[model samples]
Target: MHAFVHEGNELIYKNLNDPVIEKGKVIIALRAAGLNHRDLNIPSRRGENSIPLVLGSDGAGVIEQVGEGVKELTIGDEVIINPGLGWEKNSDAPPKGFEILGMPDNGTFAEKIVIDAKQVEKKPDHLNWDEAGVLALPALTGYRTLFTKAQVKKGDTIFIPGAGSGVATYLIQFAKAAGAKVIVTSRSKEKLGKAKEIGADLAIDTHEDWESLLRNETIDIVIDSVGRATFNRSLSVLKKGGKMITFGSTTDDEITINIRQFFYGQYQLFGSTMGSTEEFKEMLDFISKHQIKPVVDHVFPLNNTQAAFDYLRAGKQFGKVAISINR
Candidate 1:
């Protein structure tokens, strides 16, 4: 079997033995995989090891084999693999320090890989392999923030800073489905136009005098992934006692805060990561029922993953980047 391994600072395509299926695990014939920024940041365990770690986080494929005690799934079943499988255990009673998949363990970038049966779920018929491959991580992250952390509701006005990334893209669609008015911001007029095409009610240029453009205005919720670059703006736009959800720090993480904004303003700020499997399932069903689809920027072969990584690193994407692993 051939897999992409991370060697120190680079990834190499090399031959490796097929991973044996363990009890309660399943072997998936990966049809496709999706790349996220995390895949590029994991430090190699061995400084100069030749066998680079697998570099994919999300994928979907057919089941080739199932391990003992795995009754819910069988060989030949098509499934979407959820990378954040431990969220159930973590949410019930989290450990002192919990780590996500694709970091210490092997990941989904290979032709074949084995994982616990709990890590996968049947792929929704509404989604193609490429769509299923990219759905799990970003949808789960968005679901947790919108429903669990921020508790977004109908008639709520949610402001999202940056409308092109995966999380923000999902937030825009999901917020609209929930009957909330979504206001999006992007630096590019063309990107903001795309945001409107995708259902954003109002799209503003972050570089413009947005504060003045929205003078004396406030929103019920603000979801910001561009941390340092837009944190102050997010704080300034929220109505008194409103909430803001912070997820990835795509922009620089550090920012100066006015402590008075927290006290006198009575605002709530919540940080979120990936959500539980229940939330993942809920999102899948929501997409199926609502016909909400993720905006896929492009699809590449598994062999060309570096290009996808480069695209994401360059930050020019308006949606998720998927790697087709099946054919």
Candidate 2:
């Protein structure tokens, strides 16, 4: 098997002995691996330690073998790897971090990888492997953030910042499906055009005073994945009693907000992260039923992962950048 290993802050593909599946686990022959900003940001624990640690989290593949005690999936079944394995499923369970497939351990950016059978789902027959690989994370996050955390409803006007990112692209489509009027903002004009193409009701230039442009309007929900750079503006554009749902901090993590402004507006601010397994399933089903597809900016061979990282680092992509493997 060939895998990209993190050998001291760099990614290198090298030969490895075949992975042995444990009881209740399944081994997948990966076809396409999705590359995300987090994939590029995973650091070696110690400066002297290896880097590029099998370097991907999201992937789609066909089952090669199932370990003893595995029953739900079998050989030759097409599936997508679910990266978030052990967050709480029960409402009563407290939020505790669980080991993810790629960052702290082996990931899917290889010829094959093994994981618990529950971590894999049957991929939609309508989508090819490359599309399924990138759709899970972004679509699940967007679906959960808007539908559950924010409780967005029909006719709601939701504003999303950093409209060109993978999550935002999916969010716009999902929001429209829910009958919400969608407003998007991005610094890049090209990305804004792309957003409109993908069904955003309106695209606002981040460079201009969008606040003034939106002064008289009241948005029902504001999804601010861009963080600090647009946090205050997100706060400014919300309707009284409306909610603000923020997920990622692509720009900067820290931001200062006026407590008085929140009180005066009676605003509700919520933070979301990657969703649970159930949410992932719901997102997959929604995509399947609605014929929604993720926007893939580009695809690179597994060996050219560095080029993929360079592309994402430039922050000019309209959506996701994927690395094809095992195909």
User: Cα deviation in Å at residue 138, candidate 2?
Assistant: 1.6
Candidate 1 ranges with C-alpha deviation above 4 Å: 43-51, 89-97
lDDT of 1 by residue, 1-327 (tens): 666668766777667789898999999999888788777676434467554687677888999999999999989999988888456542623344545567667888889989989888899898888888888888888988998898889999999999998888889999999999998998888889989988899999888776677775569999999889899888887888999889889879898898975789999988888877777788888888889888888997877777877888888888799888758
Per-candidate TM equals 0.95, 0.96
Best by lDDT: 2
Which residue pairs collide in model 2, if any?
Answer: 6-50, 6-51, 6-52, 6-53, 7-51, 8-50, 8-51
As a whole number from 0 to 100, the lDDT of residue 98 in candidate 2 is 61
Output the worst ten-in-a-row residue range by lDDT, candidate 2.
Answer: 87-96
Please list the Cα RMSD from the true structure of every candidate, rounded to 1 decimal place.
1.9, 1.7
Where's the lowest-lDDT run of ten residues in candidate 1? 89-98
Best by TM-score: 2
